[model samples]
Target: MDGAEREVATLLEQLQGLTSNAEQVEGFRRVQEIVQHRDPSGAERRVLRGALPLLGQIVQLRNAALVTSILQLVAQEASSASSTVTTASAETLDVAAALSAGLYEVCHTVLLLSHSTEKNVVLALQLALGSLHSTFEVALRAETVENGLDTEPRRAWDAATRCLEAAAGIVAIVPEATGSDSNRSAMVWLRAWKFVESGVMLLSTAQDSSVYRDPARSNIQPNTWSLDRLSAGTQAILPKTKLEEFGVMLLKAMCEAVTSKSDNRLPLQRRELSVAVNSLSLLASLRPQHMPNILPKLTALSTVVATPGTEDPVVQKSLTANLVKLLSHPSAQVFADEVTDILIAVGASQRAFSAISKSKEQRRKYTSAPTEASLRRARIGKRTATQSITERVENANAHAKRRRVNLSESSATPIPAEKHWQLKKVRSECVILGSGETQDSKHRAKNNQHWCQFLMK
Candidate 1:
């Protein structure tokens, strides 16, 4: 074997060692640095692919450090290939094809580990989320750029598409992984949302006609294309429908989290609401046909707006403004009638608020019980804090009597104090008659003596 081949072999050994035993972490880091910066020769790249099989085996060990190293290796490979593909088109680097071979299992393993009850596994998966997104971004970039180039990189595009589909499939398994842990489900869903968001943002930038690049580097110049222009220009390669699908997936995941809450209100935080609203707004702008489908969720956000717990009024107003802005657009004029109803239902304007309040008054008659129940619970809670002194004393006495009765119920007989006292009186009378006793004793001493002990019963 050549020197490059020997290096690849040694790196693969390190990766294997790292997986079997975590002590080899430094070895894995060396491999990462070589792939990322040293720019390994083609012979070494081919040999590095050999580690793909070992990824599945090591993931079973569920060691965060080792698993992360394995994923980092894959990420570095994809990053290296990405740099090459954009710069040196003359020499094709099919990293996607090589990585896609093992991408599905890696993603699946991470998905499983993400929901682990163990803190270490969950944290490791969180750390790995960035690597997963990087991998997906490369696939998306390849797919988007396939049409822009004169000769289509069909293999890379196909591999990239498969990876994306696999990622989507992994999202479907998130619920199963979380089981009954709502917090875990929310976390998994957030990660999935972010993954989908990266794709959607890329697609959006590509689709925008207004985007322009510094034209110093064209196809001949290759990788010199400015990021903004390259991203925008790549828009021509991806279908609008495919992009919308990703956006919809993100929205679906977010909606799942919101709906999973006991009260079914959108999260009150600015960041969470902003993301949901902005995403919906972008989707509406891109796919007007889906406006009808998106309106219900937008309107249903009223509960979030009306929620008393949130301190910020601007959050609600901001959501309202976005909806109004979208509906009022000239292109959206066709949706005017539907828009009017949704606006009124969401109480976005004075007329809308009036209509809603009137209808709410009518509905309040039937729905009064829920409000009443809440008020009743609140009253019961307060009564404990402000109980009257008489009531408190009565309760204390009742409790003491109940405790005494319970103690008596457990015994075979009650104390015979009354009978013993009567016998004591008779004995004292006999003693008084038989012997002249002092008529005077300390009144306190007489009173302190137990009449029952004097009876000698």
Candidate 2:
């Protein structure tokens, strides 16, 4: 090796030996100097190439001082204005892969150090996780339509999956990360879920074959990539059965989180609950039968809704609507009547009844009763409103049935013809209301219309 190469290698070895944080920082500064010089010499290039992997090793060791030093080098290297520095490839993969690897290493380090009793180590780990999340966000934005469709997409998927799996592993090892005291962990998990949600949204959009065709020609911006592709890639590395098992494990974790009686209100737990609800919603869309499996957890969530004066109206609405939809399913009829009763009780409060009564009283006091002109006017108005509502309800049901049929036909390959037919039957059994001709039918029709709209929306 040349003199510069020898010098870099020696510095790297020496950096590894530095026991003190100050010494490690100094060593990293020196390495940054050599890398910044843009020396094309063999030694400098080799050392620059070697830095990432070696840093990765340091991260695995859970050496806070070493990880910080490595991050400093990366930040410095990243900040250089020279085109050579900016364009300088890692001799690893592109910037995406390098960033992903760095994130993976950081996650591993954080998981390892999360158990440390030392406050500083934990704090450092949290900082590193935040840095890693920011880096991934940058990488995620840099993805283009071409890159999203090519090998880069797969790498992106793998990287994200790795980060999520690592986070899950960390939480498993250190349950305290999801506990009330660890705001950092809560933030980390929230960031991860945001990424995952973005991924799922992208996948849902990309499932349209038209999106992939002429990826560059389309106006569709590549904001996110497919989770199915990510899951498939992970399944290839892991096993299909194992992937299914992992999904079940996540569901179990969610169930525990929902049911756990702890008073500790961690933001991570809330984030996890949101993730779990979205996941359950996705699974219900994919496999309606699985809705029953998650019903108990949904029921637990409903109790939260049942709690009065919660500031989260959105969460309450989502939980109640989801429960109602599940109950409306044919397989869930055992709880359908119960859900209907709850909806009635919640929807028709004394306030609403009082408002209706006050309006009737005002009408009676202001206008003469039993007048033919007023009665005819009211009849015409009611008929028009009833007709409009009937049309809307019919249109919505038609749209929903069409969606169910399309989804069923699309999966005809995996689903037995008998089962597919059964699904259609269950879907048909879901009642759709028409315009009412009688007072009792009108009330029942309005209730059915209201419930259907709530569930469909």
TM-scores for all predictions: 0.49, 0.45
| Backbone clashes (count) for model 2 | 1
Model 2's C-alpha root-mean-square deviation from the true structure amounts to 25.0
Question: Model 2 scores what on Cα lDDT?
Answer: 0.47
Q: lDDT for model 1, please.
A: 0.48
Tens digits of per-residue lDDT for model 1 on 372-449?
Answer: 677677776667534756678999999999988976764545447876577656445442222444545433335435
Q: Which stretches of candidate 1 lie over 4 Å from their true place?
A: 1-22, 26-44, 87-91, 96-108, 114-189, 201-273, 286-290, 303-315, 334-457
Model 2, residue 139: C-alpha shift (Å): 14
Instruction: Name the TM-score of candidate 1.
Output: 0.49
Worst 10 residues of 2 by lDDT: 210-219
lDDT of 2 by residue, 1-457 (tens): 5565567677877877767767776776776777667446432344455565666555544355655556555544432211232233333224444444444454445444544323333443443444433343333333422222224323533554555455444333213454544524554444434433333233232333222211111222332332333333323232345444544554444444445353333222444565656555544433333445566666656555456543245665665555554443334454554555555665733433333333233121111124677667777677877788998899999999999997677656475676556555544554555664666766665665555444332
